[model samples]
Structure formats: structure tokens, C-alpha cells
Target chain A: MTDQALGKPEADRPAKGPLIYRQAVLTRITHWVWAIALFFMLLSGLQIWNAHPALYVGQQSGFEFDNAILRIGAENTPEGPRGFTTVFGQKFDTTGVLGMSELRGTTNFVGFPGWATIPSFRDLATGRVVHFFFAWILVGALGIWAISSLLNGHLWRDVILKPRDFRELPRDIWDHARLKFHHGRSYSPLQKFAYFGVFFVLFPLIILTGLAMSPTMDAGWPWLIDLFGGRQTARTIHFLVMVLLVLFFVIHIAMVLLAGPINELRSMITGYYRTSPGTDASLPLEGRERGRGRSGGRREIPTPDSSPQGGGEQAGANRQEKSK
Target chain B: MSGLILNRRRLIGLGAASAGSLVLAGCDQFDFLGQRNDPVRDFLERANSLTYAAQRALVGQQALAREFSESEIRQGQRPNGSTDPRQNVAEYRTLEANGFAGYKLRITGLVETPKEYSLAELQNMPSRTQITRHDCVEGWSCIAKWTGVPLGRLLDEAKVKPGAKFIVYHCYDVMGGGLSKPEPYYESSDLIDAYHPQTIAAYGLNGGALPVENGAPIRIRIERALGYKQPKYVHTIEVADGFSQYGLGQGGYWEDHGYDWYGGI
Candidate 1:
């Protein structure tokens, strides 16, 4: 039944012509779950950060050591109350958003504004609760996704960069900068790089650093703290990783919009991506090629066959046949 | 796809169970669900408890908080929260006037022998001096050398009763005053932390008598926990089986207002 539904020829479905199985059912489901989990994690994390708006290096930081790398707070100036963010001894006035913000005419001294936090208030307990809850979810989802993707070859075929990707990096960046995205089944080099960085490096670092900051975790794995150069340094790295993730989100959204949000959203939601008719001919058997070349960059591009039908089935067949 | 769905369902179920357990445990005042009573908050409260339990289990009863070297001792430890007791408190003022000569630390509750020790007596006792870092929940840390009697020694001397599960510190500072009823700042710790080698009733800081602003005559240092767990200006140490009747029954003043009682991190 699954095969019949997904394996139908493109000729029989002209209305949604030249559809590519860009996202598998598992991929689509995991994608949405990740979206929800990350949303909660980000907001709640901000809420937790508000409790102590300073980031530092080394194991210990306080009035004694000049180890503070970043600090957000409000101070009384000669003019008036001002919110400031200090990084490496340089202070920047960030009033009304960070360090200090006003809600209903009452000024509040906080790290991030209430609007950006999970509970939208200065409740440290609640903030921690929310942050930790989503943290579990995020970790679980990532673990499952990683295992499944590894087994299915999705990690290497789609996310991990190949030698060819390095060669295509310049072109992919230029194309993306110009908003000239190629509507293909395989990820662009830039997309592969971004996703790979987030999935492999940033997320893992965040999780490990987070654990390092926990006192209990320190007891369980003292090496974790030592690896990060201390709990405070781990915290600083965690905050930086969060900043990188936020940047990834912005770029991801922008790319989705530029490349066509309706198509991108539909692909992720329904597992069917409507490929550009012009690019379809040039990028024929792209999915099948990915399936065959598990090591990536080793397959030759086949000429476009007249029949667009059974591309999805052909890709699956190629995966099985190659393995055999 | 079905497996993914199952995973999500399992996650949601786990979240729900966590929330449900907190509600069932009847720690409503401490749980987010009892305060705001929302599904999200409920889930978060459960998660916090899971963290608390998991960390406790992993670290075990004897794990020590990281200690630093004397070179790591930064400037004098910064004073935060309520540093000074209210001037109107007569006994506190008198104690301050006589250089804490009249000050006495009383140990009562769940003990075979209740004992009161003066500053001089506490000082004369075998002392452990270590340079340790104080990590505040607000995201800052300070290192200072502290000299005091180990709490375990004091507890042994006082002969803690077997049923005692928690050590509650009654402090002299009164906070949240002005328009409302003033409440004394108090905190408590489990026996595991109370008995830790680093846990001390410190009377000296940075080679000098502890400054009044830095908990003055005495403060409790449970090195592994956050700064708030180290209650300053301690007037009495009470060993109790439970803290159900203390400060809205959540264990500490901050705990009553939503902070976790087991603030090990």
C-alpha cells in the first residue's frame, strides 16, 4: 500500500508535475518535531539566561576575577536609567530591549526582555523548568533522528558535505546570494554545510556544554568540565552556540522564502517537492545518484530519460540494488 | 514514520507522567503547576524534578563541588542579596555593638544534645580552611578562602538524632520589609550536603574576620550548591526530619517563591 501510494508514476499525476521525494516521511515528521522543540528550547533558554545575564571564561567568575566576557544589566546614569551590554570591557547601550525593558510603564531590570522569554516574566524557577523540559525533548528528538538517519544513509547522502560540495561551494554561495536556487532533490552545498554544522557541531556542543555546567553532571563526568575549561567557559560556549543557531534560523527562513516558501513548506509537510520543470531535466536521477553513491561524489550523472515516471521508485530500487 | 510517531507519543507521555507525578506528590507549592497551573508549567516542574533526581543519583551523596587554588581567589568576595541585618532587630544590634561577643549560635531540633557556641568557641574548634569558588545562580562566581568548623563536626558534637533529614539555617537578616510583614531570610540543606567535607559554618574570610557585608560573624558554606544555599548571618542551626512547616513549606524563602529546594547547581 505504501509503495503503490508513493511509487505511482509522475505521468498519472500531471497536476503536481515532476514531484521529487525531497523529504521522506520520517524526515518530514522529525523536521516538524524539531521545529516545535527548538522553538520552546530557544525561548526558555532565554528565560534562563535572564537569571544571570553574564557570560564568563574559566571555572569561576565573580567580583574577584576579571573573567567576565559578557554582561547585561541596567545602571543609573546622570541622564536616566540605561540598559547596557558589556563585552570584553566595552559597554554598549542596549536600553529598552536587553539589560532593561519596560512593560506597562514599569521598568524591569533583566537580561533578555520578558517578551523574548518563555514565561514572559522574571521567574527563574519557571524559566529553568521550561528550559529543562524542552531540553529533554530536543535531546531525544536529535538522538532518534541521528540513529535513523545514520541507518538510512540520509546523514551522508544529504547532510554531510562531499568533495564535490567543496568544489561547488563557491557556486552554491553565489547562487544563494543571488536568490538563484536550483530546484533539485539533492541539497545545495551551502544547505548541506549549514545543516551539517547545526546537526553535528553546534547542537552537540550545546548539549555537552550544558551538561558541563550542571553540578551533578560534574560529579558524574568531571572530564566534561575540564574539557570545556571550566563550567563558566562551558556556559560561554553554550551562549555562543545559541547565537549561531539563531543566525541559522534567520538564514534558513530567508532561504525558504527566497527559494519559494509554498514549495519548501509543502515538501517538508507532505514529503513531495514540486521541482522546477527546467531544472528537472538537468538534475534527472539526482536522488538515485545520491542513493548509489553512499560515499558521495563518486557517481556519474546519467542523461535525462524521457520518462519522469517512477523516479521515486527508481531511487528506492537503486538504494536496494546498490546494496545487493 | 510510524516509529517517529511512536517516539513523539512516548515523549509526550513522558512529559505528562512527569507533570502528573509532581501533582500526585502534592508538592504543589513548589511545583510550577500548583502556582500557575498550566500544562506547560506543569511539564517544566516535572522536568526540573527529574533533573534534580537524576543529578542527585549521578553525583551520589559524597560528590564535592569544584574547589580552586589561592591564586584563583579574585578580589574580595562580592556581597549580594541582603548583607546586613535590620538595624531595628535589638539582639542583632547589640551583638554587632559588642563585636559579636554576645553572639551565640544555637543548635536545636532533632538532636540528642542542644548546644550553643559563641564566636570564640566556634573559632577555637578544629577548623578547615579552603579556598573555594562561590557560584551564584545569577551567573557569577567568586573565590575566597574560608575558615570555619566543619558542619559534620558540629553535628557530631550536637549529636544529631537519626531521623533528622535536613539542616535548616535560621539567619538574622530580614528581607521583603517596608510595606508588608518582614520575613527573616532562611535556608536549608539535606544531610548529604550538611555532612560533606566542605560544608562549614565559616567565621573567617580571606585571612580576616568575615566582613559584615560578607555574612559577618558566620555563614554556612555548602560548596557544591549555589550562593543562595549558603545562608549568611546564621543565628541558629536546626536539624529537622522535614521542612514542611518552614516558610510556606518549600524549605527556603526563595523556595517558597518558586526556587528549587535542591539547588545543587
Candidate 2:
């Protein structure tokens, strides 16, 4: 087949059909699940990471007034009982009456709002419960995605870098530097590389670093700490990975805005997509279309130009696409 | 909008723009994780003992945790470790029923006088109160008012042996004796932490007699270490130079299960 034969034609495209089949129900569900997991992990982790309460620890430098106040309150309330004893002995005439005036004073109260305080979330027992549960969900879903993707051949087919991708990578880099993709097609090769880096490397790093910090998990899998350096080092890496996750999330949203928001959003939620038909049709079928074009295999991603097929096939295809 | 469709060209541009921020964030660790070992880790471990030596030169052992107002105290301050006293429950219950008239703390191991004192006798001695933050290894912390006698005074009264460098608290919550892993529930601290001004044999919390859940008659209030170090329902005191034979040789029950022995952080 000539290159032009496989290439999408300019004008013979269908007026409307499916744009692209980049996402499905499984992808949508997993993405949202991953997003929420990242959300709680960031917030709860920040609460513990709070070395300086005045400004975010992620920021440069700030006065640590809360630490000072806590120190003073700790000193006088429980340690400085001489004053309490003297007052109690002279005024109350009873040793039973305890003094605790310093603890209640407003000077000691730290200033985040009540909503930010989330009492249930602050409890150690509660925090542990939530962390463990969400951690399991995040791990379980990722495990399924990884295993199924490998079994379905999507891992090698879509994500893994092929010889052609490697050869084209430098041109992608130069093009990216020159901002040559200003009116580019779907995704520039460099953009694809960034997406692949996040999905394959950074996300896994966050998960592994988190597991390394868990004492029970570390005991069972001591090599995890060795892999990261030590417990403290693991904690530092886990925190930094979270910062990366946040950065990626921000960039991803910005990218969606820069691209066609409706098209991107629809592609993620529903499997069907309407593309500039003629030029792209033959390209999507290099492997799968060979002996199975009767079911309109590539054309089968969306609802037919005629009638709806089994919802089961559509659902199964959605899951298969996500595993990709 | 088709206009937002960056094609391949615009997408590459956006990707290059983001790479700079990623590089900056990645390179940040070099400052915090420098070359040599952190001196802060060692300094914190030696805080209790070194602070005492420094105090001797200037303040002469006067540093203490402050006492608090009665009204500001927590109504039912939650207990951290070993809340309900087991093993000696019947005996302790009998003592509590009789207002602890016969109950006495035995100070015997490696001591000159080998003294035994009733609760009333302990109350006769000088008392100290301190409101200090009880930092837990699991990342929660709370400030509580503790009233008790300074541990140094008690050790002085008992006349600790020359070889004793650490105070091992043998609690009433017994871990079965054997080479086979015994169920661990008690904890101990070094003599430096033992003699700390904040370290006390606490008899009261929030101005009242220590509640049963809060260790009732007495418990070690080692403020510097994690909450688990504060052993409740303390039965006997043993002073030892080494912990090689002590409870699986891990210092504490939880320490045997991978918790840090010096949980100073």
C-alpha cells in the first residue's frame, strides 16, 4: 500500500460519525478514581508535611509562629505547675483543684478554619483507615489495568516505544522546541512522550514511594526502603512525587483547554468519535482490520450508521480500549 | 472548537513549555539531602542527657513543663498505650476498692535502699506539674497537663546503683516470658530521659487523680519520646546498663515490630 493510500483524504470524509475512540468507560472510571485518590493523598499528606504552619511548606521560607506558640503552651501549662500550685494552695485551700488557664487562651489556638480542620480526618485512627482503604483501591485498579493491558496486547501496541517512534522522536523534540505544533494534527510526538512519561514513570513512582513509607509494608518488603534509600528519604520522595502529580494535573487541564475541550472530553467519556474521516480511516486499521473488516471493525467503535449492536460488545470494547 | 485543536505542531510547543518546571522541581532535593550525615538526628537523640549537662552549667536543673488552668483541661483525656490494665486486674481492682491503702510501688532493682512506698507516701514527697505536648510516632500530637513527682527525686531516694544507665519499666501488662516471641505491651527509656525534668511518675491528669484508663495510680510520663514510651500501669522499676536480654532485646514491644528504638522524631 502506498503512503498516500493509507493517508486520510481531505474532502471525502463523512459529515459526522465517531471522531476518535481514545477513551471508554473503563478509562473514564479509572481516570476519575485515580484523580480522587491523588486528591486525598495530596491534602492529607500536606497536613503531615506541615513543617511551617504560616505558609505552605512547598513554598520557600516563612516564620514558624505556630511551633513557637505550641512550645510556650507546652512549657507553662503542664511543666510550669509551680504557679498553679501556689495559686491553688493559697486561694482554693485544696490540692484537688488543677490549674489549666493557659491551654484555653486564644494565643495558643492555631488559625486554619474549622472546615479545613475536618475532625474525623485529623484523628489518627480515622486517617489510617481512610489512607489504607484508598491506597488499596488505587493499587487494585492499577494492578488490573496493568495486567489486563498486557494480556490484551495494548501495552506493547500503544504505550511501548517502537523503532519508528524512536526514529521520529528527535524531530518531535525539535518541532516541540520551535513551537511548530501551533496548528498540528492530533498530538505531537513530544506531547505523546510526555503523556507516556507521566502514565508509565511518575505515577508509579508516587505509588512505590508511598508504599515504602508504610512501616508494615516496609517490614514485609524491606527492599522498598533500600530502593529509595531510607524511611525519611522515602517520605521525601513520596512528597516530591505528589508535587509532580499536581503539576501534571495542572498541565493536563491546560492541555485540554488548548486542545478541543468537547472533543477531548467526549473521547474520554464515550468511545465513539467523529474525525476528518477519509484521511484517518485506513491508518487506524493496519493491524486489526486485516481479516475482520466485515463487522466494520475500525468503523465499529461507534454506533453504526444503521442500528445499535449488542450493548455487551460496546461495553467489552470500552474495557478493552481502557486496557490499551 | 477546531481552533483549539493544536494539531501536532501546537501540542509539541506546549510540551516543551512544561519541561522547564519539571526540571526545577526534580533538582530541589540536592539542598535538603546534602553530602554528610545530618547532625540534627544525633543532637535530638542526645537532647535529654545533653540538655541536663548544659542545665547544670547554668540553670542547675530548673527547666520544667508549665502547669495549666483547671478549666482548660480535657474532660476525659484519651489514653495512648495499654489503656485497660490487664494481668494484675484483680489485684489492682482490690487496691482501687480500698482506696489503694495497701498498694505500694516497689523500688528494688539495683538500688541501695530497696524502698517500697504507698500512694499516700508518694503524695507526701515534692510534686511537679508540666503541660507538655505528647508527640506520637503515628503523627498526631496533643497537649495535656500532667502532675507528678520528678523522677530524679525518686531515683535519688532509691539510690540507683553505679552500673545502672537506663530505667527499665516493668509494667503489670506482662508479655509471656520465653525465647519464642512474647506478646509485647510494655516499654522503657534510658536514664537520661528518666531523669529529665519533664519525665515523671505521673499520679494525676487534668487536676484530678489519674483515671484508670490514664494509668490510674501511676505511669511514666516520658515527654521526649513517642506516646508508646509512656508505659501505663507500671508495676516495678529495674535499672540496667544493657538491654541485650531485655524483652527480645528490642527495648520495647513495638520496637521489636520495626518501630524505631529512639523515636525522637
Candidate 3:
């Protein structure tokens, strides 16, 4: 929603009405690089966590203290050492997946199973190595992406939500809830919000919290530790961010499959997205899907000049000429 | 801007899918990543240097780690690594048997005077007691009080040689020797950290004599580093220009075993 959108420089964007070059080559490359880097970082991070397998809050944590908010470990049971995961003092038997797990028939005590970690064995040194390396790569990729996205106008026109997007938020939510995804020239209001949240909030939070956990960073920038409460709290927040990221990952994949897997994959892989027939490349996201049996129930997204009044079907036949 | 996170998410999703298929997917096949002569391993290891250089450049050597007040010492320092070197080394056993009265810390290598100080001599020297957090590399933090003479003070008395680049802390605990003889655990600190004010050769914990399991007679505490870098049961402090003569030439026992020598993180 800036001068870039007003200019509409993409003259040949609408190829046969549906196919369009949506994602840029740089975005595609960065996306795949990030994917690979994250694959290594998350697993190696799990391997690193296997070293301690416990998380706490506040400034201090040790044998004499019981302030841990989350702990994935095993304890001596009547039969043998059984695995359990505790969250906020509530324990759950997470045998086989967490804590006690079998590695070639010999069950070992680990935070995450071998299949979930880098090296697939206990090696904190190697884990840290892989984790840190990929971490730098991720940071570098993010830096490059930030610059390229800004230069390409994707940050402002595609990702950033405007006042109109906020007004249309309910429709986007309803569309997502009912699997009524609209393949548009630009992202839906929900897509913009989600992407913006990931780009600005989660990524930065995770990275900062990660750095705050480092003793060197703590020494250099004490305010970072203070920002996150403490090193332990920073660590806990880091873990939570990882969890949220994973949730986002699963949901994103599910959405891709539900909306149109082949089209979405092509868009990501080849930077060419096949937009819906109703999607007009000339117009921005304002009223692209004007009246194509859309807006099943209540229409919350008002057109550029007027409120959209419609129904489940045959409600916008009279407004077709008015929209044109 | 969303590409990396999406990229990561897709990669993780694919990894999870492969994991469901029971194929050694994602990170499982990354065994080649850490092997010697492997390009992947070499590349990964290089990142360690990058991290080290970046951290040093950013934090510098003079920045002080956060020091907690007396009230912040909520618990005793967690005993880790080779808690009691006496269990393995007979020399340490003898020192422990005699209340460490016969123990002597030998400071050798590239220094003006290769001096030896008894436990009492080290205790009587100018000391600093500060409450600090010990951040274990395994991702845990424990705060406790530690009292010992500043390592800079000891290095000053010995008059560090010009070419000395590192201070090696040789401990009594034997962590690994592979197929060779029993090699005692050791760690090294660069001169920048070596001369830091908070780097102490500690002998007291929680206002009491340091427990045997807590490195007993002496432990080297680099305040801004991880717990593993703080070598316990330290009996020798060697000033050296390089690590070519030490275990596998990496600088310390853990470093020899693939741990990064720089433990600031």
C-alpha cells in the first residue's frame, strides 16, 4: 500500500489471467536456503538440548533450586528409569519420544530422540558446531532477504498490511476457517498479517533470545538479558519461539495443500503463481475477487468505494457491471 | 523477508515427513558434517572461528560479566565434570587426604620465574570474592560465591613472557587419554581473558573452603565463559605461546574432543 502499488509497473504480470510471477527468484533462493538452514538449526538445537534437557526461569537454576518451568528427563522408578516431561510442574509420561528412548535396542536417556537431532547421537560439541554454523547462515540469509525484499517492494506492497487490510481482517479469518482461499495478485489480509508477524516478531525475538542466552552476549550487552528477564528466561522464551515456529510450519503446509498444493509449490519453486481467474493484476488486493460466487455469508470487506452486500450464491450478479 | 522462516518451515516439514517414513532424514545423515577432511565438517568448524572472532570483536576483552549480589547466591555451585579428581588420580587422593596442605600449584612455561605456590600461599595472596553465575554449555545457569586470587595477579607475580599467548590450566582429573596414557584434564584461556580482572584461581565457594567435588584446592574461573572452560582441580598453570604441545594441539582436553576452545558463548 504505497506508491509502488499505485505505479503498477508489472504490465505483463497477468499471463492468461491466472499465471503470474509472484515470488521473485531471490525470494525463492532465500526461502530454500532458510529451509535447509532451519532444518539443521532446529535438529542440532535439539541435540544441544539433550545435554541438559531441562529449562528454568529467573537468574539462577541448579540442584538446590526447583524453579524449572519445563524439564524433559528420566527418574528412577520402581521398575527402572522412566522418561517423563514436566511442564510448569505438571508431569506427563513421554517415554519413547522424550527422555528415555531406544537407540538400537538400548534405551538411552535423552531429551529428544536420535531421529530428531543432528548426528543422531549424543555429541554436544558437534551439535553446537552445526547449530552455530547454520545460525550464522540464517542470519546472513535474513539480512540479504530484508534488503532484497525492500528493494523489490515486496516488504511494503505484499507483506505490510494497511488500514484497508485491518478492515478486511474478519473476511480473511472467515476465508481461512472455511478453506475459502482466494488466489490473488497480492497476499490476503491474513497472509500479510501472518507474514509480517513472522518477519518482524518471531524471527527477531528468537534470534535476540538466542543471543541473550550466550554468556558472551550477556557480558557485552547486559540489557539483552534484562530485556528477556534473565538468561534462563531468555532460554525458555527461545524454546517457546521454536515451538511456535514449528506450529506455524505445520499450519502453513496444511494451508498450501488445502488451497492448492501444486500451484503453491510452483509459486515457491519457480516464482510463478497461478492466480484465480477473478484476480485482476491491474488492481491491487482491494476487490480482486469481486463477485465470483465468493463471500459465502456476511461480507465484511468493503470495496474501495462502497460496502460489499452479498450472500452464499447469486448475490453479486447485479453488482458485476457496477464493479467493472 | 518471510522466505527464510517459510524456507525453514518447509524444510522442517519435509524433514518431519521423512522421519515419518523412518528414513534417516534431515539431520540424521549429517554425520559427514563433523568428520575430519569432510568439506561439510570443515565448513561447520570454520563457523566456530567466525563466532569467536565476532564475539571478541563485539564484546572486547575488558567487558565485565554481570556480577550478582550476596543475596543472589541462591544455591551452591553445581559440581560437574570431574567433580573429585581424587577418585582417579592418586596424587589428588593424597592431596585430598591431607586437607590439600601439601598441594602446590606449579606455574611453569613461558614466564619470568617458574614459581610454585602452596595452597596457603595462594590463599594469602590478594584475592577477590564475587558472586557470579556459572553458565554451563549444556544450557543451565547457577549462581554462587567464589573467592580466589585474580589470575592476573598471579600472572603479574610470575612476569608473563612476551610471546605468551595463552594460559593453560592443567588439572588433576583425567578425562580422556584415548589409546595413550591417562591424560589429565586441561583448559586454556587466551591472554585477553587471562588478564581479565574477574578471571580468578578460586579456592573458596559460598564463603567456605571449596568442596572437593567443586574443584577442592583450586579451580580456574573465567567469569565470562562457560563452566567447562573453568577447569577444576587445577594444579598447574602453564603460560604458553601456542597449543602445539598440548593434547592434540587444540588447547584443552575438551577442545581436543571437539569442543571449541573459545567458550565465551
Candidate 4:
């Protein structure tokens, strides 16, 4: 089908090229689902963190031992209620946001601001409910995504770093540092690395460490605590991983906007992506042709109107065929 | 790089605009989205119940919380929440002065024999010593050696009634002293937790007589649960069908104020 027939916007229409189907239908759906799940999880996780704004090492830690690596607390000073965050003995005044914040005109002492929490109140019950609800969704989505990605060889063909990726790494980093994003069918080495690191390493580690911290999970899998050194250590690791994930999210969004948010968002939303006109030669033609071949039953263009019924299974099949 | 900077500025501008609009729309709207009776909360409740059930299924009722070695024990168990008993209560003051000699642990409600035991009687019972970690919901942990009579033995001796589903620990410590009213600190556990082998009415901590700060002359130790569940200054054990009669009807003091009743973690 012609680019004009697809009814893409003028900005999305390249001067001399067609729109490539970048993200599969499954990818788009799961991406949005994950986005929602992670949003709730992050907020609720922050709420849970407020209950005890400290992270420690080893099997056990308490007031007796000075083993707390991180602590967010508010103290009643002569001046006023002062909020402080201590990280490895270095204390910082984080009164307005971290340890204490003004919520609806009330100066409330909480680890994170009310705006950053799920319930936006000092309610551990509500926080836990929200957290566990999204946690299950996140875990289920991740499990399904992982299994399907493996079955389709997307894990190997797309995200996994190839030997060629190593050679392209420095150039990709240099280009990204300069904000010179190349429009192509395949992800940049940097993008691949970040996505791979988050999906494979960070996500799994966070989940495992989270389980390690669960008392019930300890009964079922005692080795989890031992593997992570201790429950407290697992909690520390979980907190660190959460921080890293937040960092990744910030950078990811920045990159998306830098490259062109509308185009990037549209690709993940509708599976159609517009690349620079003359960059078709640089596109991964073999993968594209393979996708087209496997997606033979449907030829409907993924315009805004027709995207929802675009058939995720067919798109998944096409991606799988491409991987093969 | 200039193009990048311009784009970044535009992104920031867009974000600021959206955020400003959201704030202008009123923060209460956000709260309304997460209102107590919202369908989201119902969904979350279902999820929590599912987790509770699944965890129960995965880990058998008898599975014990991990125990530690003596070397692993920290400097001492840290006293949390309300450490001291209410001084205004003359009985507590008199008991404290006499080293808890007058302290009597009463076992009532849903038992064949309503019994009361003094500190000496409790200490004379067959005891078990365990070096276990006390994980607080506040994210810190401590290891201490707890020596006490197994709660199962006590329950057997008292002969728990068939309908009894929970054991409520009535404590002497009263939080937030005021002329109007003071709240007694209390905790409860299901029968499974109550009868667990590690559940004990501890009279000794770290190989010494339990300190006043650590709930002398006794505290209940349910090793599988959080520190709050192992309430300090325990004065009475009431066997009940449920804990609805307790503070706020949520089973415990902390539980009343939004903490989970099933504090397995």
C-alpha cells in the first residue's frame, strides 16, 4: 500500500519513502500495558518505602548496629521540623520532598512526597494493595513477554547484543551523545543495550530480590535469602534496582523525545514507523521482507482508525518469521 | 547539538505545561481517582487476598521462619513504638518496681480453663530457646535469642475451644499518654501462627531476663511475622473466634492504622 493510502500525517510522511512496520501488534499492546503497570508499581513502591525509609546490608540491621546504608527521616529541630536523607552517613536536607513534604497544606512526614505515592497518604494497607495488584500484572506481563519473545527468537534477533553491536557501540554512543539519532529498521546498539539490560538484568533482579525479601517466599525458597546474602541485603538491592529503573525511565523518555516522540510513540502505538527518506538503503531489508512474507494474510494499512484490529498474532508471526 | 537542545527545551516546556494543567485541575481529582471505594481498590483487594492465599498454599502452615546462630545476633533487640508501660497506672508502676513479680499473664476467652500464670510459673514450664531474626515493617532487622514456653503447650494446657480462630495479645503498654484516653498496644494472630512451633510466650531475651524495654516479664514471639505481631509487654492472651472486639476491629493496634493483619513479611 502507498504511504498516502495509509493516511499518515504530513510530518510522518517521508519525502520519498514508505512507512515501515517497526513494532509488532503484541509489542505495542504489551508496551502500553507494561507502561501502566510500571507506573502504579513505582508509585505504590514509593508508598511502601515510606513505611520504613531505610535500606540495610547483611542478614539483620537495627538501631543497635549502625548498618543502615540509607535512611530518610524527619526530626524536630529547634528551628522547625527538618527532614533529612542519610546515604552512607552523608546527610542531605530534603525537607520539601524526601523525608517530609507539605501535602494539602499539612506538613506531613513521609519518605516521598504525597504526589509520588499511590494512595497519596500514610496508608500502608492501601499502598500494599496497590503495589501487589500491579506487581502481579507486571510479573504476568513479563513472563508472557519473555516466553513469547523466546518462542519468536526476538530475544536473540532483536535485543541480544551481536558481535557487530560491539563494533557499532562506540559510534552509536557518540551519535547519541550528540543527539544524532539514525532512523533505521533495526535498533541502535545503544538502544539494544539499554533495553536488554533493563529487560533481562534489571527486571529479573528486582523481582528475585523482591521475592528474597518476602518472608513467605523464604519458607518456600530458603536459598533465595542465602543467594542474596540476607533479606535486608535483598531489600537494599531491590531499592537500588528501583532507583536504576527510574534512571532508565528518565533517559528512555529523553531519548524518545530527542529522536521524535510523536514518531516513536506512534510506532509503538500503531506498529507503523516513518524513517528518513533516503535511509531505506540502510534499513534491514531481509527482516522487513521476511515480516512481509509471513504477514501475507492481512494487507490492511495500520492507520489510526484501523490499528486496534490490526491482528497482534499475525504481527507476532511476522516478527517470528523475520527472526528465523 | 543545538537542535537537540531546542528539542529538549520543547520537551521540558511540554512536560511543564501538562504538569501545570494537572496541578491546576486540583490534586483532589487525583485522590478521587484512588478513592477508597473505587473499583480499583476492589480489584486490589482481590489481588491481595489472592496473594495471601497463594502464599499460604506455597508455604505450608507449619513452615518455620529461618533461625540464625548466636554469632548472628546483633548487639540487642531494639525497643520500638511504646517502650515503657504507662506510669500513670499504679499497678504497672508497682509491678515494674518489684521486677514484674506481681505481673500475671491471664489466658481467657474460648478456652476450657481460664488460667493465669505468674512469671515464675511461666519460666518453670518446659522451654525452647531459638536465635531468630526479628524483621520490623520499618525495614530494619535484629537477631535475638528468645527463650520461652511454646505457645502450643500453653494452648494445649488451656485447651483451646474448637471455634477459636485467633489469639489476641492484650499488652500493658499504652501509647500516647493523655488525660482523655490512652490506647493499649495489642496484637493478634490466626490459630496457625498461634500454634506454630516457633510461637512462644518469651520470658528471656539474649540469654538474660527480658528487659523492661523489651516487654518484661514476657512477650509473645511469633517468629514468622513482623516485629509488631510479636507485641511487647503482653499481659493477657485471649482466645477468640475473631478479633473484631479488639481496637478498631482490625485485629491489632498497628493493623488498625493501615498495617496488614497478616504481616508475614
TM agreement with the true structure for every prediction = 0.80, 0.43, 0.86, 0.82
Docking quality level of the chain pair in candidate 4: acceptable
> What TM value does the first chain of each candidate achieve?
0.82, 0.60, 0.82, 0.85
Model 2 regions more than 4 Å off: A1-18, A51-125, A170-188, A276-279, A282-324, B1-265
Task: Write the residue-wise lDDT of candidate 1 on B129-193 in tens digits.
Answer: 98877877766667789999999999999999988999999999887878977888899998988
List where candidate 3 sits over 4 angstroms from the true fold.
A1-16, A78-80, A283-324, B1-27, B34-38, B177-181
Between prediction 2 and prediction 4, the one with superior TM-score is: 4
- Which candidate would rank higher by lDDT, 1 or 2? 1
Give the number of the best model, judged by TM-score.
3
Model 4 agreement with the true structure over A1-324: per-residue lDDT tens digits: 322343433325334233456666666677767877887788878878898888888998767768888999999889989899999999999999999899889999989998888678776667777777778888888887877666544565568787888999999999988989887656889999999999989999999997887776786778889999999999999989999999998898898879887678667755666555444422253343433433421432333333342233223333444455
Instruction: Give the DockQ (2 decimals) of all models.
Output: 0.29, 0.03, 0.43, 0.34
The best-first sequence of candidates by TM-score reads: 3, 4, 1, 2
Error of 2 at B7 (Å): 28
The local distance difference test score of each candidate is 0.76, 0.53, 0.80, 0.77
Model 2 agreement with the true structure over A139-192: per-residue lDDT tens digits: 767777677545533344455555666788899878756644332213445565
Residue B32, model 2: Cα distance from true site in angstroms? 37
Q: Which ten residues in a row have the lowest lDDT in candidate 4 chain A?
A: A296-305
**Lowest-lDDT window of 10 residues in candidate 1 chain B?**
B25-34
**Candidate 2 local Cα displacement, residue B248, angstroms:** 30
